[model samples]
Target chain A: MRKNYFHPKNLDGVYSVYQIEGLNQDRLIKNLKNGGLTLYNVKKIANHKMSLEISVKQDKNFFAIVEKMCYTNLELKPKIDKKRKKLLKKGVIATKSECGYNIKLTRVHGKAYPLYYLFTHVGVLIGAIIFCLGAYHVDDYIFSFEFTGSGNVVENRVVEYLNSVGVEKGKRFSEFDLNVLADGILAENPLLSYAGCLKRGNKMVIELVLAKNGTDILDESIKSLSSDVDGVVKELKVYRGTPLVGVGDKVSAGDLLVDGVISHKDVQIETNVLAKVVVLAEFNYTFISQFDDRETHAELLAIESLNLPVEYSKITKQPDKDGYLYTVTLYYNRVFVAG
Target chain B: MSFLESVKEIIGLEQFPAPVFRATIIGDVAGFFEGVVDVQTWSDEQIVIRLKKGGFIINGKNLYLKKYCAGDLVVCGKITSTQRI
Candidate 1:
C-alpha cells in the first residue's frame, strides 16, 4: 500500500478526497493504483462493509475517474465539491466534508488553474448575456384597435378619425403616450362626452361615450302628434312648433295636437316643437278563470339475458295536472259584453 | 417512418420494440428490474437475478419483491449494496 501523498494528474496545489460507500476495499484499491492518480492514504472506518476513504491531488478528469470507479459497486457514491475551486483561486484553504471523504486543500502563493473556476466564470458570463437579451427583446407590436360605446356617430368615421390622429392599429405600444393621446382625441372631437385610451398587451382598447344632442326637439323635420288615449287635456305647453289643441279640450288616441312648422311673415318655417300635454282618463278592467282534471294509461315490461331473474319494481301514479285561476275587478264599473 | 409509428411518437409511446433486460435503482430503498430471465435467490436479506448479459446481487435488510409481472420485477427494502458479476 502506498502511504505517501499521491500527486494528481493535470492539477497543481489543489487536492481532493472522496469517501466511497458500499464498495469492496481490495478491488477499489487495486483499481485506484492502476488508475494513474497519486494515492495519499486509505482508511477503513469501524463498520464492516460500510465505508472507505481515499485522498488524492486534483486531476483534470476527476469526474471520469469517479465514473470508472462507480461500475464496480453499482451503488458507490463519491461526493466531491466543485465550489472549492473559487476558494482555492483566492489562496484560502477550504475544506468540505461529504458522505465518502473529507477534502482539504492548502493555501498556496502560486496560481493554480482549476477547470471548475473556468466553468464558473463562463457560466456567469453566459447568464448575464441571457438576462440582457430578455430585457431588450420586444415581440408583437399593437396589431388592432377596438372601440366601445360610440353611438350616434358613424363607426367608419370614428375609425377614420382615430387613424388620422395616430391612434390606429399596427402602431407600436412605445410609439404613443396614452394620456396625451386621449386628451388630443377629446380635444379634436367635440361629439364625444367621454374618451379613453387603454393598452391591453398588444391591443389598444378605445372607449368613447358620444354626447347626446337634445336639439331633436327643435328639429323642423319632426311631425307633431296628439294624446295617445281618450282623455281631457289637463295641461298644454308648446315651446317651438304650432299647437293644434288647447287646454280643457277632449282628445283621443292618434289625434295630432302640435305641428312641427310655424308660419311667420308669410313664410312657413319647419322646426321640432317641444311640448308637454298631460291627459287624465278613467276606465275599468276584468279577468276570467278556467280549469280541468283527468287521468289515463299504465304499462310495464321485464327483460333479462342468459339467466332469467324477475325483478319486482313498485309503480306509483301521481296527479298529472294542478294550477289556479284568478278573477278580480280593478275599478268599480259595470262590465259590458258584445252580444 | 410509418403512419402508425409517427402517430405513436406524437402521442408519446416510449415502449421498447424488443424485450431487453434493464434495472433501475432509486436511491437505496427500491429497484425496478425488467426483462428478468430468472430469479436465482429471493429473501429478506438478499436478492439475485439473472439478466441478459450477467447477474446482479442486491444485499439489504427487509428486502421483498414488491411486484412482478411478465419479465418485470420490483424489489423494495433498506438496500446497502448492489454488485454486478
Candidate 2:
C-alpha cells in the first residue's frame, strides 16, 4: 500500500490518495489527510488519479502516519472503466490506447512482452537460417580451370593429359601436383612440345603448345650433317621409304640410318625413296645391390618340441633336414640312456 | 679540325641530328647517362636501353623500323625514332 497527497482547486482541502488494489476514494482521501491539509495540482497514474503539491505540517512521523492510514481499514470496489469492461467482455480491443498518448499499451502485459521479444528474436533466427541455407546450397564457391595458347595445337593434348592424370571435373584442385603432372604428361606424350600446369581453387588448368611437324632430321649419309654427340637410334620412322634395320640393330653416329637412294639402273624404274634404321651402339651404365641376411636366417629354421610322461624336450632346426640325422641315445631324467 | 670531323659536323647540321651516332663511355662515365639514350642497335624489334649502367636488349613486336639506314631520319606515326644502324 502507498499513499500520495495531491491538491485540486475543486477540493476544499488537500486530498490524500490511497494507492491500493481497489477504489474507496472518499474514505481514502478523508482518512489519509486531516482537515489541516491544503491543495495544489492533480495527475493520473496507471490505475488511479491523484493530486500533487498538497501542504502538510512538517513532522518526523508524517510520512509514516500517512502510509499507515492509507493501508488501514481499506475496502476496494474496483472502479473499472466501462469502455474497458465492455471491450474485455466483447474481446475486441486486444490493445488499448492511453487516453492522451499515441502509443497503445496491451491490456495483458505478459502476453505482449513475449510477443514483442518473439518478433525480433524470430526475425533474427529466420535470417540466420536463410543465411546458412544459402551458404550450404550456393555453388559460387568452385574450382576454376584456366587455359592458354592457340586453339589448334596444344589445347586438346593438354586437356586430355590433365584428364588422364586424375585432374578431371569435380576433383579438388589441391590434389594435383601441377609441375610434376605437367612434366609427366609432356614426357608421356611426345607430341606436346611444352606444357605448363596451374591449379586455381579446385580446378587444374594446363597450358601447352605443340611441337611443329616436319622438323628436319639430320641427314647422316651426308657426313657433314651430324650431331656432336653419338646417339643410338631408339626409334626410326620412314616417311618416304622402308625401314632398313629392325629394333636392336647397331649403327654408327654418322652412318646413313635413313637413305634417300634409288635403283633406277634396273629395268623396273625405282622412285626416290627413303629408308629408316634403328641402332644401339654404346651407353654408360651403373649398377646397385642391397641384401639382408636376417630374412634368410628366419626362412631356414623351424622350432620342434617333444614330450614324455614327466619331461619335455625343445629344439630348433631346419625343416628339410629332419630324416638324415639318426637318434642314437635317449636319457630319461638322467637315470638311464637307451637307443 | 680534320676533314672527317668537319664532314661529321656538316652532316649533323644538314640531317635531323644525324639520326645514328656511336658513343663509347667506360668506367665512371657509364653511370651518368644510363637510360637517357633510346637507341635500336639490332633490328627495330631489338632496342638497346641502359639499365644500372649496363646494356639491356628489349625485344619489341614490330620490326618495320629496321630498314632505315644509319643516318636516316626514321619517323613512325608522329613518334620521333632514332637508332644506331
Candidate with best TM-score: 1
Candidate with best lDDT? 1
Residue A106 lDDT, candidate 1, scale 0-100: 30
Interface RMSD for each predicted structure: 17.9, 53.9
Please provide, for model 2 over A294-330, each residue's C-alpha lDDT reduced to its tens digit, 9 standing for 90 to 100: 2323222211121322122222222223222212111
Worst 10 residues of 1 chain A by lDDT: A330-339
Candidate 1 interface CA RMSD, Å: 17.9
Residue A41 in candidate 1 has what lDDT? 28
lDDT of 1 by residue, A149-186 (tens): 76424344466567777766666777788787777666
Runs of candidate 2 exceeding 4 Å displacement = A1-98, A104-146, A189-194, A199-204, A210-339, B1-85
